[model samples]
Target: MTNENNPIDFGAFTEPKKRPEPVSAPEESKKEKGRGERQEWVSRQPAAEPVAPQKATEGQISIKGPDHIIERFKQLCKDDRRVYYDMLEILMDKFEGK
Candidate 1:
């Protein structure tokens, strides 16, 4: 079996695959050393004080719609809460002539 009409010879494609070189022990040690140095630097830094949660600056808007519509909307946003909020922002922007 052969592809006679093809300009390129397919027989040249069967070259032996080259195996990847193994990582030397020193390289592995250096990686570990680098990680340890990073951890040490991070640990040396001053700990941040716990921040209290800030209340929403803009008052919340409650939309009263049919239960099925609200349920469908919630289902659409099942993957992410940001999707729903971002969509609301987009709609509001369109209405406000932004």
Candidate 2:
């Protein structure tokens, strides 16, 4: 369970370095926030308001195909940096000679 006689020699290790003391906020910043308390960075930045999700206008369609073919189609779309449905629409339009 235990390896008292290891083949490799790890060698002597040096002592861990001590962490630096935490820096207090500037006098002006402490005065703005309140004395002795650290000013959090998040408080300095504007608060993010919740955004409403936009609804998609286009209707959705389901697809059925061989796993390998589907994977290759998805990979092709990814390589072209195009959305799967957008790529299909473009291909269909091209085939229509439009």
Best by TM-score: 2
Model 2 spans > 4 angstroms off: 1-56
lDDT of each: 0.72, 0.81
- Tell me the TM-score of each prediction against the true structure: 0.30, 0.41
Q: How would you encode candidate 1's per-residue C-alpha lDDT over 13-81 as one tens digit per residue? A: 887899999966655565686755432434765588778899877656799999999888777677455
Clash numbers, per candidate: 0, 0
Residue pairs clashing in model 1 are none
lDDT of 2 by residue, 1-98 (tens): 23578755555556789999999856776666745566555666547876879988888887899999989989989999999898998989999999
What is every candidate's alpha-carbon RMSD to the true fold? 15.1, 11.5
Tell me how candidate 2 scores on lDDT: 0.81
